[model samples]
Target: MGIDGVVFGCLTPNNWLDEEALDRLIEAAEGLQITFHMAFDQIPTTQQFEAIDWLSEHGIHRILTHGGPRNTAINENLEQLRKLVNYANQRLTILPGGGVTVDNAEELAKQINVNEVHGTKIISLPEENND
Candidate 1:
């Protein structure tokens, strides 16, 4: 597939994963950068940290989260997102997404100090390439 990375669109509610299966998937992907996408917000609040711990331990590169349920503004979940950013400091990266816009990326990054942010505002591709 010569793919650069993979993002799991949704994870189990508890972030439950089969490590052996994951290892196999990683092997199949040939070590493409792995990201647990926005579905991370579906995990229970109490379980988020634990899941992060396990994910970081498993060598996941990033977790794209809005800090709460999907479609919610990251602005509204700053506290939780900040906590996750701090917790993931050196182990794994937390890529904030959902409702993040170019106008607000600065404010969000200023507060969280994370170098990477993910959302529609970051890039805008033409509706149809005229090639």
Candidate 2:
């Protein structure tokens, strides 16, 4: 893999993250040649912005977020999350994951206005396993 960067997936605990954990994650990421893409749980818009700002201060350029749970798909929360990402587009690359699927990936890509969308299984299992 010619990937020059990496994404660090950390679950936001209880809708809130411990500063100690964040600090440690940042420290760990700094040792690598990859850009850290932090994946957070369902956090408020304000907090989400704060997280992005904090990561930026630490030199993290990519941010990935869990797009809510599966139930939220029908409630428009996913769309709302996308809006938040778009709002913060100037600061970093806001990539959404978790519930992303091929069916709604195009919609998410369009709504978020991001060229890339990340997912664990975006490619079929066989393709992923092949490498």
Candidate 3:
């Protein structure tokens, strides 16, 4: 439909990547950019790096993640996020999301040395209209 890119994700009941399902999605994408979404965070920490390697090897362009458990502040997840960025080694982009906000996004990006991030609040709104 002329879209430039698509976010794709699938996980098994055990929180591992569902390669079969993902393959279908990738095949359907037909060369559009693929960003594996926050489902990356649902995988167990012990397996996350391996998942990164797998996704990179399989042609995923990036991953959107919170860097740690759901609902935790992004600051607390910085260490793990940094590790993920390092392990990726430019093989794929690590786009942090979850608790990121305009107020903290710049500092967080510098702290992790990543060029991109994700969040609804990436652009701030006035307090009265904020939602």
Which has the better lDDT: candidate 2, or candidate 3?
3
Q: What is the C-alpha lDDT of each candidate?
A: 0.79, 0.62, 0.94
**Candidate 1 lDDT trough over 10 residues, lowest sum:** 9-18
lDDT of 1 by residue, 67-125 (tens): 88776767889999999988887699999888888788878978888888888886655
Model 3 scores worst on lDDT over the 10 consecutive residues at 122-131
| Cα-lDDT of candidate 3 | 0.94
- Per-residue lDDT tens digits of candidate 3, residues 1-131? 57999997999999999999998888898779999999999999999999999999888999999989887999999999999999999999999999889899999999999999898989976568666
Model 2 misses residue 120 by how many Å?
3.2
Q: Summarize candidate 2's per-residue lDDT along 14-97 as a digit string, tens digits.
A: 565455666777776665543444345455555776766766676666667655544555226566567657666667676676
Single out the weakest 10-residue window by summed lDDT for candidate 2: 33-42
Q: TM-score for every candidate vs. truth?
A: 0.81, 0.65, 0.92
Candidates 2 and 3, the one with greater TM-score: 3
Q: State the number of backbone clashes in model 2.
A: 0
Tell me which residue pairs clash in candidate 3.
Answer: none
